[model samples]
Target: MKILITNDDGIYSPGIAALAKIAAAFGEVRIVAPDVEQSSMGHAITHSRPLSLKKSPIAFDGKEAYRVNGTPADCVALGLHIYPDTEVVLSGINMGPNLGNSMWHSGTLAAAKQAVLLGITGIALSTPVGKTEPDFNAFADYVKEALEVIFENKKLGLYNVNFPPQPKGLRWTRQSVRLYDGKVVPALDPMARKHYWITVTPLEQAEEGTDRWAVEHDFVSITPLRLDLTNEDELKKQLDSAVELNKQL
Candidate 1:
């Protein structure tokens, strides 16, 4: 398999290196990623400016590599366009998790989403933050297993995989649905200028089987994400209601 690897954590992050090592074991690898961190950038592309790329060698076993001055989505776009034969696109071993509602704003997930839009299979991998820091080597087995299942199921579309701090095993999970207590903290800089920092405190879910719950319980969460955002149930209901109202009028 020809794998195209990309990430939102920039080209030099250890997370990407770990991911590259795992990908190298599968087949020939090619990496195209941002020259700098593009975290939380979502599926943004370099629309206004001419996107540029340059060769930036890393310690991966990839056959070719490039660094882009663009978002993670742009990296995947360029990688697929440049290497038209790429069979799979793997985005991240992101330093942060892209779970629940966060996937909508995660550049890591956006890379995979972009690849899927281009009619290619893609997966996004992420690890949780913990006090022990990361030991990527420990995640090799879990990462490889996720790849195995993904490869076997080509029609799975976009997948978001998040490993717990210490993974016990993997679980197919649903995305969590809950609101966050997002706050904008105010602070003053040394120059006495007031600035605001946005922070999130996630609300607890009583429900299990969600990505967030699985991860919190030491399980690797794999949620199959889709490009289609249509809520078909609501759509059908609203359409029916409209038709009934028209008949009454």
Candidate 2:
């Protein structure tokens, strides 16, 4: 089995390095990640500028590695388009957690989504949420266990996996039905130019049996996700209403 490893946290981040070590246990691993942190870039691809790929001597326990001047999605796109035969695409082992509403804006998860769009199996892994300092060391074992479960299941599709700060165990979960409480922090530069950074406050409430709740309760969260955004039920309902309206029109 050949696995392609990539992340939004840049090529040299410890998170990606640790992920590479674990992925190497599964197959011949190839690393092609962003040269700089893309973080919450979502599923954006570079269209305004050309992308650059450079071979890197950086080895994941002697595995081949490369860096790309692009977003996380770009890495997977280039990887599959260039390699064509890669069996699995494993993204992240991200520095910060991707849970709840964060998945919508995470480049880490976006990379995996891109792989799924290309007809390949993909998994996006993330560490627990934290403040000043993130404790990635505490979640290393959890990551290993999650990878084992993921590798054993061939039916798994594009999805997001989030480990708690130090999970007690694992739990299959559904996406949180709650939304984010967001805020923007105001700041000023020396030149008195105003700027704002979007900051996530916290969910006011979370329904039970969700990924957010699982993480909060000290369990690793695995939420199966898909790229399809169509609301089939709503679409059908609207179509029925349209038919009714056509009788008068």
Candidate 3:
């Protein structure tokens, strides 16, 4: 299997290096990522300007690695073009977790999503961070296990995976859908210039069997995902209404 590894945390991030090392066991692994951090960039593509790929300044376990001057999605686009036979695209081992609704704007997940959009299997893996950097060596085995679980199921074209610092086991999970309180806090810099910071807080507790709950309970969470955003139930209701209106006319 040919695997393309990437991340939103930039080319120099230890998370990507760690992932590349483990993924080498699976297949031929190549690293292509942003030259600088592109966290929370979502599934954005950079069409306005020409993008460039350069040899990584740092080595990734001696893997062939390149850095791109674009978003996480752009890296995947260019990487797949360069290696058209890539079978799987693994994004992250991100610096932070991408659980729950945060997937909406997560560049880590975006890289994986891009792969799935281009008709390949894509998986995004992440873990929570604390005051210090995560000891990735401690969770190396779990990373391998996560890959095994994802690969065994060929039907799963896309997945969002999250691991607790020390996972007891793995669990199949669904995306956590809950309400949140979005906030914009104003602040002043040392120069007394006003600035604003946007953040969010969850309003409800995580539901059981969800990605958030699985990770909270110290299990690796793997949530299968799809590209479609359509609400089938709502579509059916709208179609039924249209039929009734047509009959009345």
- Tens digits of per-residue lDDT, candidate 1, 40-69, equal 999998889899999986756636889999
Off by over 4 Å in 3: none
lDDT of 2: 0.86
Best by lDDT: 3
Cα miss at 237, model 2 (Å)? 1.3
**How many residue pairs clash in each candidate at the backbone level?**
0, 0, 0
Q: For residues 48-109, could you state the per-residue lDDT of candidate 3 as single tens digits?
A: 99999999989776789999999999999999999999999999989899989999999999
Error of 2 at 16 (Å): 0.3
What is the alpha-carbon lDDT of model 3 when measured against the actual structure?
A: 0.94
Per-candidate TM-scores read 0.95, 0.92, 0.97
Candidate 2 lowest-lDDT run of ten = 128-137
Model 1 residue 27 distance off true place after TM-score fit, in angstroms: 1.1
Q: What's the candidate order when arranged by decreasing lDDT?
A: 3, 1, 2
lDDT (10s digit) by residue, model 2, range 1-249: 889999999998888888887777777888899999999999999999999999875767777788999999999998887788898899988878788888889999999999998888899998764565456777878888888887787874887898877689998888875656689899999999999998886666766678888888889888889788899999999999999999979
Worst 10 residues of 1 by lDDT: 56-65
